[model samples]
Every structure is written in C-alpha cells, then in structure tokens.
Target: MAQAHHMRIGEVAERTGLSLRTIRYYGEVDLVVPSARSRGGYRLYTETDVDRLQLIKRMKPLGFSLDETRELLAAVDGLSADDTDEDERAALAERLDSFEAAIADRCVTLRRQLEMAEEFAERLRRRRAGRAASA
Candidate 1:
C-alpha cells in the first residue's frame, strides 16, 4: 500500500490559502484537526486535511457561520464513510441537499449585490467623464 503524504502547517496554509492563525483556530474549533504530529510535536496534515480547510475557506464568502460549516462538514463526512447504513446515508444526503439550497440562494443574492455595485461604479465613471468633458 502506498503511504499517505503529510505536510507541515506552513505548507498546508500555502496550499489552502489560509493564514497560519486561522488554520490553528480551525484545529482548536475541531473543524480540521491535523492527521498526525511530528516527532517534535508539530502539527502534521494530510491532503485530506488541506481539502477540508479549502472547503471552509469557500464557505466563508457565502456567510456561513462556524456552526453551519461544521454541520455541512459532518454531513459530507458521514456520506463519505464506507460503513454508513442506508438510513443514515439518506439523512446525510438530506442535510447536504439543504446546504446546497442555501448556497444557491446565497449565490443569487451575491450576484444581485455585485450587479448593483457595478452599476454604481459605472455611474461614478460617467459622472467623472462628464466633469472632464466640461472642463
């Protein structure tokens, strides 16, 4: 069997685009605990751990709270487990569906906000151009 690759905290941060402090806080919050420790007691992470951090980073822009991110991660983990029974899998699927719906709604709202901001910026540009023309 191939051995799993491991990385230290700094590499994980660079790969996941998360700050060192944020990664440590996620560990403290039980969001993405390291997969192992080095002989010197430094935190060691696997590729899977980096993936989880990336997921959390994506959730941040969508206004997901820590609790919500945790819940979603739980559902995803449950679904991915090999020993999950049919009934449990169904429940986890339902939870994932709800999260998907919420994400879609948030995306729509974000698009609307982006459109408004763009419109405002265009208006400002037009005003500036008018002033330049008059001068």
Candidate 2:
C-alpha cells in the first residue's frame, strides 16, 4: 500500500538532507513537489516524495539540469509494469547511459577541484611554517 504523506516540509527537509530554502526552490522549479498542503497551506510530503528529494539530492552533485532531471525521471516512469516494449527499453537505456556518463565526468572534475584545494592548503601551511621559522 502507498503510505500517506504525513510529514510537513520542515521534517522532510531534515530527513532528506536538504535545506528548507532548497526544498522550496525545488518545488518552485517543478522538481520534487510536495504531496499535500495543510489547511494553512503548509507543505506536506509522503515517504515517496522524500525519496524523490533524496534522488534529487544525489543528482545535484552530478550537476544535472532540472530539465534533464525531469526527463530522466519521466523515462523511468514510462516503464510501467505491463507496458514493456523493447524499443522503449532501448530508449530508456540510452538516456540512462547519457546520465551515467555525465555523472562520471562531474566526478572527474570534482576530483581535480579537490586536488587543487589540497595543494592550496599545503602551500598555506608551508608559508605559515616558514614565517614561524624566520621569527
């Protein structure tokens, strides 16, 4: 059975490792939308909706565009249980491949950034040590 979406936006924010501002912005951008609203219009989220947010969180680091995110989700959603066709499966596979490649590329870029940051930190440490020796 599909569980009821019981949690408010703040709870969802905490559970999903996202800021409230980021969650609201995701809603505004038509990413992971809230499942319900309170009588006072406060947003509520289902477990599934929170799961969606988690997926979005994972995607964010990979630098996927909102439209690409939507498209990838749509491609997976298109694979309804009884609607399986080879052509559709092939299309979905192709889209997934593209997303995988993009994520891998971002990982390499991030590693390079980390290396640069580490080098900068080492330089600062060396400079501090040199000044201390001179003093």
> How far is 87's C-alpha from truth in model 1 (Å)?
0.5
What's the CA error at residue 56 for candidate 2, in Å?
1.4
**Best candidate per lDDT, number?**
1
lDDT of 2 by residue, 7-89 (tens): 99889988988999999998998887888888999998899788888888888787888998888776766664458688988
Please report, in order, the local distance difference test score of every candidate based on alpha carbons: 0.97, 0.86
Candidate 1 whole-model C-alpha lDDT, 0 to 1: 0.97
Which residue segments of model 1 deviate by more than 4 Å? none
Summed over model 2, clashes come to 1
For all predictions, the C-alpha RMSD in Å is: 0.6, 2.2
Error of model 1, residue 109, in angstroms: 0.3
Tens digits of per-residue lDDT for model 1 on 93-131? 999999999999999999999999999999999999999
